[model samples]
Target: MSDNNEYQGRIVVITGASSGFGRGTALELAKRGASVVLAARSPEALTELAQECETAGGRAMAVPTDVSDRNAVAALTDKAVARFGRIDVWINGAGVAAVGRFDQVPLEDHEQVIRTDLLGVTYGSHHAMSHFRARGKGTLINIASALGKIPTPLYASYVASKFGVVGLGDALRQELGEEKITDIRVCTVMPMAHETEFFEHAGNYTGKKAVPIPPTYDPKTTIDELVRLVVEPEDEVITGWQGGPFSFLHRLMPKAIEKLMAGNTNAVQMGESMPAPKTSGIIHQPSKA
Candidate 1:
């Protein structure tokens, strides 16, 4: 249960609402009395999630959307406004990844990860900012990863996309400050590896079962931070207990941190994991699982 009055009268739009942090956040906000607009590639999943949100005691709208498509993202915004009047918050939580040695993963997989993760955030941020500018207030939350600050092996494209997200958030904040837009906030959330369907959906060519790095925290930890951000927006937030220290270490010793992370990923994702056949996962299409 949540404090129903905390988010009363608020409307939030969440991409990748079918699963992972996006879904968890939506449900939590809904329980707190926020109207949630859900967007994801799978219509069925979105529909189901919408029902769950409503059942949890808040309004919900399911919009089948591919965030990679600018037009689809625009339409998602339009639809949310049509039903809810305006969006108080927009969360760009949609992302995808391909895990393997950079060259071994298909060029198409790498391109798709960029298109969905990086470009999708760009599209969502563009529309959210436009709306915020019109209303003179709103919060844009971009869900980046710890990898954005400390690059690691086995996730080249994901790292690149998350780095872009972090940079994008920083630039947006700078522009807002320069323009004296005090009410509009741009926040980036960087969370360490956590238990989520993200790994299940990632394209894997590592010849080993894809698993989250060790010391993975529960998804709830990251979800709680996201919910808190909606109430108290910050320029940047690093969730998970390990995220802060790891990022700090990287800042102090970039080369050593990088080498250590590469070895850690290899040990956990390759050496410790079971053998598996290569599969494209969900990079090119929606997951059927």
Candidate 2:
């Protein structure tokens, strides 16, 4: 449990708030008395989530946004600030994945994944940092994946995007430190495969069902970690029981860890899952699911 007082009067802007970690974190923050500004591609879903957040005992606003578009993201920031005066924390959690061999997946799919996952974070960070600098203090959290640290075979584009996110966070921290910006904080979260709508919404060309890698943890664990970050922002955090150990092993023995990850991805995401036809998934559009 968290100290509810910690979040009292705080304002948070969360992208991808329609589902998964973003939704869960919003509810948790709402319970803790933080105002939440929800952004997602689905207006209906965002409206419903906003109502739920208010019901959870916090202020709420819904802003339908597609983070990939720079203009849209800019408008989202403007709307959040307009609604809440200023944002105390900003979470860039919007992302998409395309699953298949690098060559097999459509070129457009790969581009879309990069645009949504990596570029989306970039845009959010840019706007958030600008606001934080002017406000004199704020926290920016980027949701990355364990694949950012350790490469897997199937999710090539996703791994690339996450790696970019990790690097981007590091660069931002370095810049902030050089500028003597002590109050503004940048944190990147890396988590192993968890139970979320991610798998179901992933574009698949592998002719097999999209499923999480083995040892998928519960979404609550990731949500708890996100909430913790809000209270005590750190530079980089690896969530889940397996995340730390795997990251450590990868650093110590890159080749061996890569081999193991490849085998695991093959066994679970490819071999173990049922056959399914190719689908564009939510990469091209919002999922009706």
Candidate 3:
């Protein structure tokens, strides 16, 4: 059976298409017969993904793009539209996360994440809306995180960015409804670190590093569920139990939730310096020490 209804021949644009869930979801959508638009800053990775999609008997294209650039994003939309004549779906998967304590984290750290995670969605969805307004149908999918709802310790910037995404998606859903734009759907995909390469590149505070929780808790096993929802349709989905508690406890008991997470210095790591993500966002590379 097809994983999509009315998705055959549809054009789907995915940002951060080089690795992780972006890459995985792009290929899977191709397998489902959706024409995929693979996007990212890394040309080599996207080029390889394109070839793989083709080898799978699916039509695909690798467009090297930095979603933080409005011009680049518009070009991305233009290319997708030029290739397929219209866009059926837009997925903003490009994001960066920093794991560290609040004080140790630099203010400049999150600008990149906000650009790619929050503003990238703004650009993609804005462009998608213009296209959908003309065509009368389309969907905007932003890959948020479970922390979008519950703020996390180590990933303050990441959580803030994702929280913006969740708020953006929810608000846009309302804005589109008010405008009578019934065909456009705005949603978010919330997932933890799957088996993707993001972990290696995940930015962290110089203050500390934390132990690995469970790899199974990551994306590989749960990614299918995320892809399934984007293919089908949904409001918002909580993917795992690591995520389940926050929503439940936060709602039923906010004070208790904060108390539980209070002063949990688990994520703080003291150090000289660590690697910052280069291929992910538009932030300047940290000075080489």
Using all chains and alpha carbons, the TM-scores for the candidates as numbered come to: 0.98, 0.98, 0.85
Note the clash tally of each candidate. Answer: 0, 0, 8
Output the TM-score of candidate 2: 0.98
lDDT of 1: 0.92
Which residue segments of model 2 deviate by more than 4 Å? Answer: none
**Candidate 3, residue 179: CA error in Å?**
3.6
Clashing pairs in 3: 193-218, 194-218, 194-219, 207-269, 207-270, 208-268, 208-269, 208-270
Model 1 C-alpha lDDT per residue in residues 1-289, reported as the tens digit of each score: 3355768878999998999999999999988888999999999999999999999998999999999899999999999999999999999998999999999999999999999999999999999999999999999999999988988888999999999999999999999999989999999999998999988888999999899987898999989888877868999999888788888888899999899999999999989998889998988888785
Any runs in candidate 1 off by more than 4 Å, and if so which?
Answer: 1-4
lDDT of 3 by residue, 148-261 (tens): 876656667777888888998899888887888776787777775455656556565443333332323656555576466555667777776666666787889877765555
lDDT for 271 in candidate 3 is 29
lDDT by residue (tens digit), candidate 2, 1-289: 5688999989999999999999999999998999999999999999889999999999999999999999999999999888789999999999999999899999999999999999999999999999999989999999999888998987999999999999999999999999999899999999888999998999999999999987789999989989888879999998888889888988999999999989989888778899999988999888786
Q: Please tell me which model should have the higher TM-score, number 2 or number 3.
A: 2
For all predictions, the C-alpha RMSD in Å is 1.2, 0.9, 4.0
